[model samples]
Target chain A: MKKIKQIFYLGIKGSNSFLAASLSAGNKVKLSGLASFEEIFRSVEKESSAAGILPLENSLSGSIYEIYDLLTDSKTFITAETEVRINHALMQKERTGLQKIRYCLSHPEVFRQCRRFFSDNPSIETVPVADTASAAKMLKELGPDTACVANPAAAAVNNLRIKKEHLEDNRNNYSRFITVGRKLKQHGNKISLMFNLKHVPGSLYKALSPYARLGLNLTKIESRPIPGRLWEYLFYVDFELNNGKHGFDEIITAMKMLTKNLKVLGRYDKYDKIKNS
Target chain B: MKKIKQIFYLGIKGSNSFLAASLSAGNKVKLSGLASFEEIFRSVEKESSAAGILPLENSLSGSIYEIYDLLTDSKTFITAETEVRINHALMQKERTGLQKIRYCLSHPEVFRQCRRFFSDNPSIETVPVADTASAAKMLKELGPDTACVANPAAAAVNNLRIKKEHLEDNRNNYSRFITVGRKLKQHGNKISLMFNLKHVPGSLYKALSPYARLGLNLTKIESRPIPGRLWEYLFYVDFELNNGKHGFDEIITAMKMLTKNLKVLGRYDKYDKIKNS
Candidate 1:
């Protein structure tokens, strides 16, 4: 067996991150949880046997800004990616009728997802908790009337009774999870690059010119704000290599001239850059 | 005065959104609250005399993703921008010591800001609420032991007493707010443009080149993900016009060839894009 491959994720077990990590890890893998995303990245960069699964973006919620910030700050690379279908259910201490539950407890994102459910039951008061796991604990402590929106794992772990299943407004809700590693794995054709551009005029346009000149197809382009520096943004771009090989070197050389600092984040095959898009 | 200039904001009275709107609006402005961000956008676009102030980016938290998504989906343009200093305090029903508080309640963002306070007092169990305004309302209902992280306005409006002030770790926390309207107000040197490019290689690079040749400085470049169409992104850029006057016509003509669809979002001055950044 491969000496127990180590995998890290945000939050403890029964979390969405944990669920994704479990689904993505190989045989004999030891899954562990980190308190913060920063810890996960730190461990992944230090240990070659380790990898981390982080929620990059949710289909409904857009991108997780903190994850991108941590990724840029670390020496890690995106090795793989996966999607976790977010399934939120209303759980309580016992089988209570919808009318009996006065308060609903869950994360704010969970509340956003169950917008329709809350709207339909105007009498039910919605209270945002930290996360699903915490919501479960709070349900036990905060009295019987406080219901929680949870995933299957959270409900099972906490031994809470499910009052209703499929509470989320949309059935197709998903969060795109990306696996990070210390070593750049040559597992796919898509390459990710991040760079800081000069504040001068035409710098951004000049920086992107090389990729356009080489006829490279960009799969993604994202910009994250720097904390203290408000005007300048760090650009992250993911593009499929020219025919899965040539023209990468040329593009890098061209980027070096335009950008103050640039880092090749990773190169991997994107499982499905989304089917319809 | 000035026909009671209408300004729309997110959330009801005694909320952070309301606070930002109040600070950003001009004299004789009649501010109104909207139930949802979508409603604010719809009202702003349909009414010629109306404008809505939406939170764009926070210095510490980064971009507000939902606002960006809504901005792209609507015909409204960003007409003005401003920054509001975020101040959070510890409030409760009584002037009880921190030791008396068993449960700390507030928005998750508020909790994040008071990380130091929480770590120092590990016994305080944090319960995240919808927002500061709701947290204040909950303090009246959820018992006196629950202390809330709140703004001064929320405390005053909800009749909650302040226990501790300046609970936020960073004194430099500020949120960038933008006023959106139907008309593209051309009051500043900066111009905002958004475009959806074809999936073909080099399309984005080609689209940005005209500005580079003309030496127009790009102040901002943000990309928002399109739901269902996961891979495709809408690029929003703010570039300073060449010498604050020329080359805009030439760049627009070139962009027409490369982009599938393009919208000129607006042109207005950014009130201090952040001094240090």
Candidate 2:
């Protein structure tokens, strides 16, 4: 068996460090430093790392555009995928009560999840940190008076006491992460493409007509702003098509006539939740 | 004219508050407490407020969904509108040095705008507060050691010093605010509506077909997730059909058959820099 190379994880704060540690499991895949999308991309481009994991979307906050834009702009291809179920907890140092937490540190999303907790305690000021793991790090450094709202893994990793567990508003809160590398290898059975339609009425409907006519089932479609254009949008679409040669060619031909700018990001199987499931 | 009552302003942390204050002009309308969509909705519904001014969209951040959702859900009517050129600034107390500042507080959107500024100073943490005005309030309470990144009005309102200004990633920053009340007495030329088409192909095409047929030009269309539903969306549309009587019923009838759900929020004349254009 070929040896697995070093993997670097790039994400926008939160519990990415904990997730990376879990993904590594008992393997010898040494986890590199946790960095931002721009930093990780630079590292990958300069051959400083072999593979990197990035958060594609969150259940509550929707898409992380920075990573998406970086993914599209880079020559990397998604190699593997995983979903991390986030169980948010309010953590502080040992022997501290909830009322003693004068300052709360967390990401915007975590702050949003525990809105009720914060609302009930209006006197406690909430501070927005860049990442959940970093919040834990800071909480450990700041000691008992400062509590951090982060995942249990974050609390455990930083040796902080979990004051309150399962603080997320929704029970099934999850974030999907994708591994991107310099090579192209399809493991899953799905094709993802992104495109932009003209800023006119029925433009999106017209663009998707051929697919609907051919009985192609679209799995997901998300629209994000096209920078520089005040209100224009670009749609990212994922769909399931046959993996064989004939079925693939026909879809490409249909896509060609649908929009002016078409980018076939990759074709891979749906990233299933096998490990945690 | 009748004595104007209190005006409820839905301040967007920084720029919108200044624009709203300026638009109130010499009228008897006094700026009530600055509030967000939820706060404004609850305030106006219970109080005797005359008008509510809230932001609809910004050039960089797209639409403020909390305001839009409030507009659609509440009993507010469109009365007037205004626009403001946004200029974000990094602010602190007069004598505080940039290096001395340990924490920076602002709205999440403003924090995003000045991400580059924070990138340069990795040691200083960026914190997201309720709004720009609130951030300024915290800065005043926390003293000079904690700086705030906000608008000039926010700085003046909270008595904070502007350490640095115009800290946006993009130069052409602008935000549009709308005035809504329970009465349609004030005139406007634009109509805004929201609806949902069946998830099939060409549904949106057929739904928008009548607007083109009636020669009524459509201005804007935006989509937001239908709360508590997966794989479904409701689209918000702004259009030009100010005639009030002609072709309104027919256009709505055509759209009903082509869509699963349709809701007309309100209608008004084109936003005149001050009143209806």
Candidate 3:
């Protein structure tokens, strides 16, 4: 078995994923870029020490249910959680002014996010690429009259000069990322779990009664639809353990008896704890 | 103010939205295609009789939270509910064999969904267009060698011939759509409401106890994060009142006093009920 000090993320270098991976792994582990989300999980699953960083949800866009579905299917377990503030910056090969650029290259989603910038500067023609990272890499390749919108990390990685900062329409946009490892972390202040309730009236309430009775703080709760089953849903819940893992085992034992197909996704501290530490 | 017998949707003719709008509005109303979701809501807000159809959730992709946010901000309410079985078909200007096709035009999402089809036939190059509807519109312009992936409706609308059906990798994929109108739907069995709690312990359980007490069946329950509020979330719950509008007024009065910012999004029947009737 091959083991390396590497963390995998989706997309090329200098993306929001790259930034989050860099932060989550810190300077100890090397960051590796993969083509797809599934590939990242595959790499981590193969090597136990390696980790995969996936953007699970965005403040504005909501949760990435595909990743949740992937997490359910994969043998990996969540170990850590982090947040990356999305800041899209416009850059070019040369230090050209906004008026000098004729073509602006970016992902279609990025273009939509920075809609106001283009509407204000109607002279710039928008070109959609596969991703923001590629857009930055293609800045010089496209020509001197072109600019690309990407993360500031991309500006450093691709050696492009920043023309504008915070180009997104909403400044409050943030993506919550999770680091998935082969083994679960047994210690943390918060725990994430998912379960399926039996098809009976008040089953949902009965399942939730444990948390309310034990005074467990449910930070997030959402029900996701099961594909072939039509209206039947899988519930994903996250709660904070106030007493610092006091009843972690007991809670798990209690929940296992109450719910069906109960899966403990992870145990981790909130983003604030990591930020403060 | 001018009002026409038109029901608006997001994309052009022959798209999934168009199919949903058609099923929702029936043959009496002319299905109109709009450029954006916001525009459709705006049009309906101006004219009370007019309605807009929006895709709310996909069995595979999950809920479109942006639409939920829009619903929270807008005056419109969900008047009806319908489901559209997503069927992507390969078509072209002429009835050409799969071997004759050189390029396939479709929305990037459609191309991703039909990844298996392209992988099986490596000779065909995928061209990512704006949408499936426009892909069909551009088929004749792109020539006989070029094929497009879209709904079967596009084949009839654009005067093209379908070469293959069920091109998507997952045949069971479905999108649930909701018709939003100016006034509340007064007589449907299921009711959708969203509320924010006062940040107290057991507030969620307390809010849910009402349902358990009455044995109300909760079809769907989801938590949507409020942007800029960090961890706070607004709960969206859909419950079926089996007694046929019995205690409807009393429950509204009871919940009004129990919850904060409680907004009754709509009253609508299940898709199965509509499909059968």
Q: Using Cα atoms with residue i matched to residue i, what is each candidate's TM-score against the true structure?
A: 0.85, 0.76, 0.92
Models ranked on lDDT: 3, 1, 2
Pitting candidate 2 against candidate 3, the one with the higher DockQ is: 3
**The TM-score obtained by chain A of candidate 3 when compared with the true chain A:** 0.94
How well is each residue in B59-161 modelled by candidate 3, as lDDT tens digits? 6667777688788889999987887888889998988788999998887778777878898999999876657888899897877889999998888889999
Candidate 1 chain A: worst 10 consecutive residues by lDDT?
A268-277
Model 3 residue runs over 4 Å out of place are A1-4, A273-277, B1-4, B273-277
Clashes within 3 Å, all models in order:
3, 14, 0
lDDT of 2 by residue, B158-248 (tens): 6777888788766656666776766544335576777875555445555666765566656666555454464566777776663655456
TM-score of chain B of 2: 0.77
Query: Alpha-carbon interface RMSD of model 2?
Result: 4.8
CAPRI category for model 3: medium
- Order of candidates by TM-score, top first? 3, 1, 2
Which CAPRI level is candidate 2? acceptable
The better candidate by DockQ, 1 or 3, is 1
Tens-place lDDT per residue, model 3, A97-168, is: 778999888877687778788889999998766578878988867788899899888999999999889988
